[model samples]
Target: MKTTAIGYSENLPAAHPEALLSREVPVPEPGPRDLLVEVEAVSVNPVDVKLRAGAPADGFRVLGFDAAGTVRAVGAEATLFAPGDEVFYAGSIGRPGTNQRLHLVDERIVGRKPTALSFADAAALPLTAITAWEALFDRLRLEEDSAGTLLVIGATGGVGSVMLQLAEALLPDVAVIATASDDARAARMRELGAEHVVNHREDLVAQVLEIAPEGVDRLFTAHSEGQIERYAEIVRPFGHVVAIDDGPRDVSPLKGRSISWHWELMFTRPLLETPDMIEQHRLLDAVADLVDRGRIRSTAATVLGPISPAALREAHELVERGRTVGKVVVHGWEEAIDSARESTDIY
Candidate 1:
C-alpha cells in the first residue's frame, strides 16, 4: 500500500526544505465506488498555498485539488470507470489530495480526460472549470436567455480565465466586461472573449459604467477580500453577485440595491456527498466536449516540470505571491526531480 507522495508536516515558508517533504505513505484501500488512479499531472491552486501556510498537520498533509490520471483499479461498486481509463478530477476536500502517485477518488466526481489535451493540460481545467460552471449556472443562474452585462472583477487568474470563456461559449449574447491590471492582461482578456476589458487598478465603477451605462447585471469575483464594496457599486439594482474566495462578506452595502451575494465552492458537492455530486462528472465531461470541439482552452499557463517537493514548493511560492497569470502545474513523476535540488528535492 506504500506509494510516493509529497507533503508538509509543518507550516513553513516555501523556501524552507521542509515545506514539502517526500515520503512513503500508506495508500488507503479503495472504498466502494472509488477509483484508484496513478496520477499523471497536477495543478496548483490558492487553496494549496493557504492550507500549507496555515493548516496544521499531524504527520504530513498532502494538499492538491486538480489532477489528471489513469485508473489503475476500481472498487467493487465502481462502474463509472475501469482500469486504464484516462480521467481528470478535482478531488473531495474530505479525502487525501491528488499530490501522490496513487490517489483514491469517487467515480461520481471524476470525468473522462479530454482526449485533445495532454495530462498536464487536462489537469488545469477540472477545478477552475467546475468553479466557473457552478458559479455561472448554479449560483448566478446565468441561463441562455439571461441577458445583461456580466462583469468579472479579477479576470486574469485561473478561475477568471475559464469564466470568460464559459460566458462567451454559453451566453453568446451577453456582454462581458473583464477587469485586468496591465496591458498584457487586458489583451489576454480580449483574446479569451471579453467584450470589454477594463483596468482593475483604476476606478472599476467608472470603467465598467462606460461600457454598461446602468450597471453590470452580474459580477464574479475570484478574490473577494476588499472587493465587496466595489461589487455593491458596479452591480445593477436587484442584480446577482457570485464570489469564489473565502473571507468576511459584509453585504450591508449591497442591501440598498437588493443585490444578492452568493458564494461558490467547487468542492461543495463532493465534500457533502450531495445527491447531485454526479454533476461534477457531467460538467467536466461537458467541458471536455467543449475542449475537443475547440470552444474553450486550458488555463495552465505555467508548468513547473515534475511532481516533486522542489517543483511543488516553487509552484506554491508562485501562487502565494498572488501574481500567477494562470494555473501552475507539474507533470510526470520523473527521477530527475529528486536529484535536482540536493537537500530540498523530494520525489
Candidate 2:
C-alpha cells in the first residue's frame, strides 16, 4: 500500500513556491520495536525548517517530527501499543519523518495521545514538551519542589509556552520569569503561569535584576543569537543554563561565574539510539497525563487546514519567520482515498 506525503528533493528556501511538494510514497513497514501509525495530525517546528533548508538533493526528505496518529500495526518486539491505539511522538531524525499518511516510528519513542485533546492539539505537544521536560529536570537537574527563580528567554514560542506551564505545575514553589517583547505575548505567558514577564528587546539583565536582585537561579534559553554571554552575567553563581538553538557561541564568560551551559536536542536519544531511548516514551506519557488532567494545555495556536503541500508550505513560512507564538498544525490528508490510491507511489 502507499500513502500521500509532502516532501522535497532539493534544499530550497521556503521563499520558493516549490520548496515543498505533494507526492505518494510507499507505506513503510514496522521494524522490530516499531509501530506503523496512520497519521491524523502533525505540527511544524523550527527543526523542520532547519532540516528542509539542508535536505539532500538525491532522495526526498520528509520533514515533520511531531505527530498524533493511531497505530495500524506493530513490530514483532513492540509491546507498548497494539493496532488502533492512539499515540503521539517526535520521530527520529534518522528515518523518514511523519509528513506521510502512514509513518513507522519506534514504539519506544511513542506515547499515548492525550485523552482530552483532538489529534491536532495532541500533535503540538511531543517535540516541545519533551524538549522542555528534559531541559529543566534532566539537564538543569531542577528539583520538583525547589524554590528558585527560572528565567525563560523567548517564553511565548512553542517550547517556551509549554515550558512555562510545566515549570509552574512541576516546580510549584519556583518563580517563573518569562521574556516576551510585546504586551500580548507577555500576557499570554502570564496566562500560562509565568509569575513575571520581561521584555526581551530591552535590557534583559536590567529587567531580570529589577525582579530578582540576586539574579535568576536558572536560565532556559529558547532563542539565543548574540545574547548567550549575557546569560552568564544574569545567572547566579553556579546556576545552570540550557539552550536549544544551534549557533557559534563563546561560553568563556560562563566559566568564570561557575555557570554551566547545556544544550538540549529532543532528537538526541533516538538519533543516537541510546539505551535510554525509552525515556521519551515515558516523558510523553507523563505530558499526556498532564494535559488530560488540565495541568498543561496544548500550545497549538494555528491550524493550517489539511495536510497538503500548499498548507505545509504556508506553515513552514510561518515557522521560518520566527514570529509564530505557538505551534502550527495540519490535520488529515487533503486528497480523497481514491485519489490517493491512484497517485504514483515511490518505494
Candidate 3:
C-alpha cells in the first residue's frame, strides 16, 4: 500500500509554488517496537521550517514531527498499543517524519491520545509538550515543591504556551514570570497562569527584577541567541538556565555566578534509542490525564484546514514568521487531492 505526502525536493522559500508538493510514496513497514499509524492530523513547528529550508536535492525530506493518529498495525515487539489505539507522538528525528498518511513510530515514544481533545488539538501538544516537559523537569531539575522564581522567555510560542500551562499546574508553589511583546499575548500568558508578564522588546532584566527583587531562580529561554548576558544578570547566582534553540555564544558570563546552561531536544531519546526512551510515553500519558482533568488546555489557536500541500505551506509560512501565538494545526487529509496527485516520489 502507498500513502500521499507533501515534500520539497530542494530548498526554497515558502511563497514559492514548488516549496511543498504532494506525491505518492510506499508506506513503510513497521520495525520491531514500531506502530503503523493512519495519520489524522499534524502541527507545524520551527524545526519543520528549519529542516525544510535545508532539504537536500538528493531526496525528498518530509518535515512534520507532531501527529495524532490511529494505529493500523503493530510490530512484533510493540505490545504497548493495539491496532485500533488512538495515539499522539513526536516522531524520532533520525527517521522519516510524520507528514505522510501512514507513519511508523516507535511505540515507546507514543502515547494514548487524550480522550478529551480532538485530533487537531492533540496534535499540537506532542512536540511542544515533550520539549517543554523535558526542558523544565529533566534539564532544569525543578520539582513540584520547589520554591523559586522562573522567567519564561518567548512565552507565547507553541512550546512556551504549553510550558506555561505545565509550569502553572505542576509547579504551583513556584513563581512564573513570562515574557510577551504585546498586551494580548500578555493576557494570554496570564490566563495560562503566569504570575507576571513582561514585554520582551524592552529591558528584560529591569522588568524581571521588578517581580523578583533579587533574581529568578531559573530561566527557560526559547530565544537563547545573544541573550546570555541578560540571562546572567536576571538569573540568580547558582541558578540554572535551559534553552531549546542553538547559536554561537560565549559562556564566560555564566561561569562567574556558577549558572549552568542546559539544552533540550525531544528527539534525543529515540535518536539514540536510549534506555529511557519510554519516558516520553509516560510523560505524554500524564499530559493526557492533565488535559482530561482540566488542568491543561490545547494550544492550537490556528487551524489551517486539511492536510494538503497548500494548507501545509501556509502553516509553514505562519511558523517561519515567528509571530504565531500558539500551535497551528492542519487536520485530516483530502482524499480527492491525495488520489489525484501524480508527482513522482523519489525516495
Backbone clash tally (model 3):
0
lDDT score, candidate 3, position 91 = 94
lDDT of 2 by residue, 153-269 (tens): 988888889999998889999999999988988888999999999998899899999998988999998777777678877999888889998843688778888988899998889
Ranked candidates (TM-score, high to low): 3, 1, 2
Per-residue CA lDDT of model 1 for 1-347, tens digit only, reads: 69998889999998898899998988878899999999999999988988898998777888898999999999999998999999999998888899999999999999999999999999999999999999999998888877888988788988889999998889988899898999999999999999999988888788887888788899888777877787777888999988888745477888999998899999999999999999999999999999999989999889977799999999998888888888899998876456556547453
Q: Write down the lDDT of every candidate, Cα atoms only.
A: 0.90, 0.89, 0.90
Compose the digit string of candidate 3's lDDT tens values, residues 214-331.
8899999888888888888998999999888884378778998999888888999999999999999999999999999999999998987679889999999999988788899999
Q: Candidate 2: where is the Cα deviation over 4 Å?
A: 336-347
* Pairs with backbone N, CA or C atoms under 3 Å apart (clashes), candidate 3: none
Clashes of each: 0, 0, 0
What's the C-alpha lDDT at position 120 in model 1? 95
